[model samples]
Target chain A: MMAVTGQFMILYVIAHVLGNYTIFAGAINAYAEGLRHWPYTIILWSSRTLLLISVFLHTWYGIILKLENRKAKPETYALTRYRSASLAGRTMVWSGLLIALFLIFHLLHFTFQVIEPGIAATAHPDALGRPDVLTMVVGSFQRAGIAALYVVGVLGLGLHLYHGIESSIQTEGLNNDRTLPVVVRTGMAISVVLFLMYAAIPVSILMGILK
Target chain B: MNLTLYVWRQEDRNDKGRLVQYEARDISRDVSFLEMLDIVNEGLVKKGDDPISFDSDCREGICGMCGQVVNGVAHGPRKKTTVCQLHMRHFKDGDTLYIEPFRARAFPVIKDLIVDRTAMEKIIESGGYISVHTGGVPDGNAVLIAKRDADAAMDAAECIGCGACIAACPNGSAMLFTAAKVSHLAMLPQGRIEAGSRVCVMTEEMLKQGFGNCSNHYECEAVCPKGIKVRFIAKLYREFIKAKGNL
Candidate 1:
């Protein structure tokens, strides 16, 4: 359950990041406007519903599995030396929890506009009579603290994905001896790329490259 | 080599175990780990004190009768080696070793440094075998299995059911052991007949034995004496998915 839902969220993240790149081309407002209006809204809402369900199921099953894992090993070793398990692989629960918190804060700050209502794009329309998403996003990322927070969040995301992607593949039985090394390396590479792409937005805005 | 050992001493299954420190003096570097323990046991016997009890039989790695967590790494720090086969040369003089039994809820402590691994036996009993009609001994070349398949099956078959994989896993998952059993048989023509049902039944039994789910830590592979790969677990999942689809 965790693997399937996590893969679904990964697909959504890929699309979401690609859409986010529109901000660089100054088409974010129109993009955001198109997303909320007319037939596109149907797709938007369906995706949102699916994402919500996926997050819920992922968190729920992740918690249950973690708890069972804890119970299975009631006692810990006095001294442990990990030979193959990576640091990220060992700290999945911690990184997952951080991502959950970051997701909530991100939704409140941007999607719901509950954290900073004054800069909400929904209230201030662009010259083309569309939601000023670009203004809202730029204004938010311009802050050093928020940008740093976003960087940290994306770092957590990268760490989570570093282990999660290949784990899901293995769990789904899509990996084999011949493909294991490739799968692991590809998972790490994709995670690093996604991190750079996502972190680049806030970093560029904070550096005054995107206004 | 002299060493400081903190060995777990448990009276019985219900006793709360504690680490009791002992000084192992003048131990030869060539002696096996279990032999060093035997030396310590000899001292205890001379002193009329209760000797530290640990499990060992063949003193060789094949029997799978001896196991313990030495310095937290299952079967000690030597890679692909069981405790019985682990020599004292791996340790330095004055090295402090923390020895503990294989700890998992399913494998309760029977005594000092000994855990009851009958849970693994139960998993094996579920579906780790294939049945055949009673008849004359079949010809060896009758089943024309591919070389790759035979080699893979042999690799999986190297598992001695030592339970080190479980001890090494953070979640105490028996997926490696169970996967080895499933993969070896599933790769063979005779065992492929019931591969689907075999995987389903064995997995169910594994879960019921209080073993944890695989989280892909790959620690099991690292500590496996026979060097069983985690790919078998993936194959187990594949067989399981195929079984579910057939259902």
Candidate 2:
């Protein structure tokens, strides 16, 4: 169930991020503007909310299982020497904490408050007169610190992504040798793109290419 | 091949241990594991430093005295080989080996890689014997055991009481070792009469020793020097369950 919820979480995050990608063609302001007055904005926000809940539940299971294993088997092995168990078993708690922190900071930066006041982020119409996202992203990344922070945050997201993404697929029972490597690689590729694309906006602004 | 040994150096059981790296140069690959350690100790002695502390008497695998966590692996990665029988060729030249003691909660570090394995002796003392009167040494054919039963019993009896089972088991349960001893005697016709009582007392003693419970991880079976099967545990469990009902 933890694995299933984790997979569900990845799916939701991917969809949300892809939706956020509309800013690539337009601008950050255009994406926020899209959120403000759009056909699917309500559903977009609702799915993200559900994704947050799934992440919380999955992390909770990881913590509970670690605690149980610690009590049942405190030592790594019979010998006092060092040993490596599963990567997920060792780092799930730390990774889950980082993801939780990133979510809060992310909401504060974009959803609740426009941390940069003077950045022109008005919800304007785009190609189809749907609120454009391109301008909002460009305007937000214009601030050097904000862009750097976003890059670093996404890097943390990347760390969580690589481990969580593959394990989630395995947990969901599609764990055959033939398909497992493919799913793992695909999950990694998706996360790397998410991080790179999200970071590119800030880097572009830093390079004086935007706002 | 020559290797650097990052041996755990502790003066006593209560000492705060640290890695004291030593150059165990010119050691032979064909040398038995303890013999290589003996050469290192000889080097330490010549330099007037304290020799690296480890255990071995028979220098043969039968003593069950030598074992350490070499490079994060118990008994140095040899399948079913005791530390005494393990040769140095398995290690690569110029390897930095991390040596430490077997680390179960019940097995406290005495000094260096040696642990206080007296807990194993206690489990055996609980009921690893028959209470039958010994007037004269009974004839070997008195029990008239079949060959298969006798062979299996001997295989189970081959457990050297090394506590390797305890070290390898993730939970540190001595069930394999305890069960081996139990199965050894219980399979015999003369020993079957007291099988129920023998298993119960030993199991209770195992718990009293503060070892963790078994979780069926099978690492114990993987590292056991005697190659004892987990089936002995099943046999012990059967006798235990029956004993509980009788209680």
Candidate 3:
């Protein structure tokens, strides 16, 4: 269940990154406005609902898997050693929790306007007379502290996605000798690229490349 | 070669094990790891001290009877080698080794360096076989099998059931072991008749035996003495999903 939900979230995350690119082109306000009007609104709300279901299922299954893993080894090894499990694989729970926290923070900061109130929160209008989401993103990223948090959050996301994608493929029975290495490498490359793209927004703002 | 051994000692299933240090003096580098232990046991016998007890039968890697965590690595540091085949030459002079039974909730320590692996047997008993009539033996060529399928089946059949995968797994999962059994059978025509029901029953038995689910760490493959691959796990999943869908 976690693997299936994780695959769904991967698609959502890629779409989210593409949507965020609207900010770079200074059309974030228009994009936000576009999402709220016409047939797009139904599609938008449906995707949101689907994402919520995936998050809930993914997290609940993750906790259950963790408990099951713990029950298998009631006694701890005095000196444990890892041979093939990677650092990302070992720290999956930590990275997952970090991404969850980031998701909550992200929703509050951008969607609800309950945190990191900025120009967008004040209902400032862009040239197209829509809420200035581009300014809001810029103003938030301008601060070194907020930008650093974004960097950390994306890195955690990268770590989570790296293992999650590979594991999901295997769990879904797509892993074979011929395709296993390719799946692993492709998952890792996509994770790194996604992290870099998300990190670019905050980094570009902090570097004064964007206003 | 002289070496120091910190062997885990437990009187019974309920007894708490502790590391007891023993001096292994005048050990030969040419001897297998089990033979090194034999030298130490001889001294203990002559002194009327309780000899350290460990499991061994074939004194070869083929028998899954001998296994212990040597310096935190299952079946010692060498890849694809069991403790029975692990020679003393792999260790340096004056080296210290930490030897302990395979640790898992399902595999309890029966005595010093010996764990109860019958939990694995219980899982196998659950559904690891096919029912056949007590008739004359069928010809070997009766059931024609493709070369690819036979090769894949043999690859998974290499699992030695050493429980090293469980000891090495962070989750202590028996997925690799169970998967090997399931996949090796599922690929063949004879075993394919009951593959669906067999996988379901065996997997349920594994979970009931207190084994954890595989989290795709691939640690089992790295530590397996028989060099079993983790891809069998994927095949197990396919078999399971197919079975459930049919149900």
Per-residue accuracy of model 2 over A1-211 as CA lDDT, tens digit each: 5767777777776676676665555554455555665676887778777777877777777676556445534546323432322343345567677767877877765655455444323344566665334555566677677787778777777766766676555433344435655876786787788778767767877787755
List model 3 lDDT by residue over B167-226, tens digit each.
998898999999999999899877998999999999999999999989998989999999
Stretches of candidate 3 exceeding 4 Å from the true structure:
none
Ranking by lDDT: 1, 3, 2
Model 2 spans with C-alpha error above 4 angstroms: A1-211
Worst 10 residues of 1 chain B by lDDT: B130-139
Sort order, DockQ high to low: 1, 3, 2
**What does candidate 2's lDDT look like per residue over B96-120, in tens digits?**
8888777777788899889899888
Candidate structures ordered by TM-score, highest first: 1, 3, 2
Question: Which candidate do you rate higher for TM-score, 1 or 2?
Answer: 1
Please provide TM-scores, in order, for all candidate models, with all chains considered together: 0.97, 0.58, 0.97
Q: Scoring each candidate complex against the real one, what DockQ results?
A: 0.88, 0.09, 0.79
Listed per model, the TM-scores of chain A against the true chain A are 0.97, 0.75, 0.95
Instruction: Write the number of the candidate with greater TM-score, choosing between 2 and 3.
Output: 3
| After superposition, candidate 1 runs with Cα above 4 Å error | A37-39
Docking class of 2: incorrect
